[model samples]
Target: MLRTLYRALWWLAAPAAVTRLLLRSRQERGYREHIAERFGCTAGRPLDDHAPLIWVHAVSVGETRAAQPLIEALLQARPDARVLLTHMTPGGRATGEQIFGERVLRSYLPYDVPHAVRRFLRAWRPTLGLVMETEVWPTLIEECQRRGVPLVLTNARMSARSFRRASRFGAATREVFGGFSRVLAQSPADAERLLALGARNVTVLGNLKFDMNTPAEQVAQGHAWRAAFGARPVWVAASTREGEEEQVLQAFAALNVARALLILVPRHPQRFAEVAALVARHRLRCERRSSWAVDGAVAGTAEKLDEDVQVWLGDSMGELGAYYAAADIAFIGGSLLPFGGQNLIEACAVGVPVLIGPHVFNFTQATADAVAAGAVLQVQDAAELARTLQTLFSDKPQRTAMGAAAAAFAARHRGATARTVEVLLTLLP
Candidate 1:
């Protein structure tokens, strides 16, 4: 009865959902391109019958990037298997294309209405399904189960805040979680929460982000960029959400380090222009990453900027590793307010000393573990963040030690991909 009502609500909201997508498309044109696919009107080349089709739903960029190692492992394990990647956001689809290229098929997953879900399932007929992170669709789960398709919630995490919210949904939440064939959690705390939510066959396989190996080319590019930066204390504010950037820019404006470069990378691509304008409003001289050129060619080896350029706006996509690699210190954003924290692990993986805000319930375990390892430091607000940055910039030895620890902390958390693949293959037909 609950599932029926949930389906009814989604059906009723379909018009609004379409309108929202159209509104978003004004900022990001890609959102408008795949409108039909979102409504389950996906018509593409027929699937290869001989090869097993594996469907993986990664809602956006973060999930899509985290699924990289697992997806690669799956293809390696089952050479003939065809991996079908589905996403709801254009950024995620673009990231999938940038990372996987021709390796995996990409499509926008339909909205969670019964008819759309049925059409999507019928079109793909995936032998197995893996939903990344915390996405739980009741109608889709029910449909997958009804079709006898084994669905797994891979790299699952449930923050306390999220748990409390899900708990409010009562049996409806449990029904969705319980529908998964298996729940591969990121940590013991996550596993415990999933169990409470009635998820069955749950296993703690760590985080796939830990298993992600930074692209070698990106690392080299970062090194080149750092060399170009030439002793300027470079710090990256990576994957910052809305409202957080204003605080960060204000902090950057107050920071005392002379000729220091602040690489501000907003989490969303649509906000690139807005962030640039924000930097301008601070009266800080800013040079955009996209505008950086080497001898008239754009996006090549970084050219040295004028000493007056206080902020380097990272407006490009798929080059986060390079940005982290180019930085002396990294601040993981999204934690300043109440949006939880962005991934600090990525910065740590690049061997950079990290700082985060007080709010990190989304990455509670990872933040705790990183802090325990001396790889990360927590600050209460923007003022403290600026103070910490000033102190860290002056203390080179402490920064070096923290960088080493960050690398070690990242190295210690590897192998989740292998474990995830092992479990996933067991469920494959």
Candidate 2:
């Protein structure tokens, strides 16, 4: 009865959900493009009889990138298998196009209404379902189970706060989570949480984000960008969120370090203009990557700025590795403002020393491991962050040591992708 009520509530919210999508379309136009796919009107895609169709749902850019290694492994191991990738956000869809091209079928995952879910299942007929990190929808799980489609939640994690909220629903939460055939957790704590939430067959398979490699081309591009800047004391504040940018800018200004450059990459593309305006409000000259030359030179003489640009706004998409590569030190943002945190693993992968603020509950295990490994530094707030950067800037040896430790730390956490794929193989027919 509770399940039926929940479904009815979702049905009633359909109009509001569409309205939300239309509002979001103002910032990212892809939200308006695939209305039919969101309703499960996907058709005309050929299915291979010999090869099984495996569906993977990665809701946004972060999960989409995290699933890359797994997707590649599936295609490599099962030569006959066809992969269908679905996402809830336009950025994820655009990223899918950039990364996978026509190799996999791409679509917006239908809203979790029974009609839409049924239409989706009938259209795709996937042999198994792999959902990335904590995207459990009751109706989707129920429909998948009814259709006899085995579902696995990979890189799964439940925060203490999230667990408490789920506890409110009592048996319904348990029923939803319990329906999964398996849950591959990111850590032991996550496994415990999942078990308490009524999940069965849980395994601690580590984090898939750890297994994703920084592309070689992106690394080379980083070198080019560094060359463009030429010997400026460069640092990156990556995946920064709003309200945090003003903090970052203030922290950077406090340092007052001469000839220093900050590469600020906001978390969302829609916020690029807003961030640029923030930079102006702070009286800092900046360069937006979108306006910056793609093939031309850095527009200045060697080891000198043409106009003393203080910040390089990373407004373009799909080049995070380059940003990480081009920096001497990295500050993982979103942590400063109780926004959980952004992934710091990419910085570690590229051998850059990292700093993160106090609130990193979203990536608890990873942050703890990185801190223990001497791969990252934690600061109390923007003020301490500025002090730490200044201290590190004055101490080259400490920075070098931290960077080496970061690279080693990332290397030690690999093999999760292989383990995840091994479990996935068992679920496939």
Candidate 3:
């Protein structure tokens, strides 16, 4: 009965959702493409009948990237398997293309309405489905169960705020969560939360982000960038959310280091121009990454950039590893104004010292673990973040030690991909 009403609500809201997507396409044109897929109209080539279809749904860029190692492992294990990857956002779809290319079948997951999901399932007929992170769609789950598709919630995490919200739904939440055939959590705390929410067969499997192997080419690109930089102290503010950029720019304006370069990469591509403008407002000499590419390559020598450029706006995509590699220190964003922080594991994987803001409820266990391992330092606000950057910039020995610790911390948490793959394959027929 509850699900019926929920479906009704979604039916009513479907038009609004379509409108939102169309509006978002103004900033990101990828949304404009693949319109039919969102409504469950899959017009692509027919699926290969001989190969087993494995479906994985990742809503956005982060989840999509986190699913990388797992996807690769699954493909490696089942050579005859065809993975169907679904995402909600244009950025996620774009990132999928950038990472996987023609290797995996990609489509936008339909809005969680009965007809759309039914059409999607009918068209694809996946043998098993894996929903990444915390996405729980009641209608989709119910439909999957009705069709006998074994659905698992992989790399599951439930933050305290999320737990409280789900608790408020009482039995409805439990019924939805109980629909999953398995729930592989990132931590024991996450497993406990999932169990409390009535998810059965819950297991703690650590974080898949920790298992991400930095691209060797990107690492080489970072080395080239660093060489071109010629000893300028470099720090990157990676994946800064909306409000956090203002604070970060303000703090960068007050920094006292000589020839220091701040690389600001906004979390959303839509805000790239806005962030570049913000840097100009601060009166800092800025260079846009998109402007200076040479010979069809994104990164060229630093001589292309003005010596006085204080900020290098990271406006390009799929080069985060290179950015982290080029940096002496990295500040993970989305935390300064309470958006729950961006992933610091990427920077740590590159052996760069990391600093983050106080609000990290979204990544509670990972952040706590990183701090305990001395790979991360938390600052309360922009002021403290600036102060820490200044101190760390001057103290190379401490930064070196912290970088080593960060690398060790990342190395220690590997093999989640293997563990997760072993568990996932067991569920397959």
Q: For each candidate, give its TM-score against the true structure.
A: 0.97, 0.96, 0.97
Residue-by-residue lDDT tens digits, candidate 1, 97-160 = 9999999988999999888888888888889999998888888899999999999999999999
lDDT of 1 at 50: 55
lDDT tens digits by residue: candidate 2, 1-429? 888898899889988888988998898787888888887888825564545889999999999999999999999999788999999999999898899999998889999898899899888888899999989988899999999999999999988878888888888889999999999999999999999999999999999998989888788778777878877799999999989999999899989677899999999998998999999999988988777765422323224334489999999889999899889999999999999898999999999999999989899889999999999999989999999999999899999999999999999999999999999999887
Task: Return the lDDT, model 3, position 400.
Answer: 97
Which residue runs does candidate 1 get wrong by more than 4 Å? 44-48, 294-301
Cα lDDT computed for each candidate against the true fold: 0.90, 0.90, 0.89
RMSD (Å) per prediction: 1.9, 2.1, 1.7
Q: Please give the TM-score that candidate 1 achieves against the real structure.
A: 0.97
**Over all chains combined, what TM-score does candidate 2 have?**
0.96
lDDT of 3 by residue, 1-429 (tens): 777788889889888887887898888888788888888999544765756889999999999999999999999999888899999988888889888999999889988888889999988888899999989999899999999999999989999989999998899999999999999999999999999999999999889999988898888788777766666899999999998888998778678899999989998999998888888888889988788653312445544456788899999888899889989999999889889777889899899999999999899988999999999999998889889999999999999999999999999999899999999999887
What C-alpha root-mean-square deviation, in Å, does candidate 2 show against the real structure?
A: 2.1
Please report how far candidate 3 places residue 395 from its true position, in Å.
Answer: 0.7
Which consecutive 10 residues in model 1 have the weakest lDDT in total?
Answer: 293-302
Q: Model 2 scores what on Cα lDDT?
A: 0.90
User: How many collisions between residues are there in candidate 2?
Assistant: 0
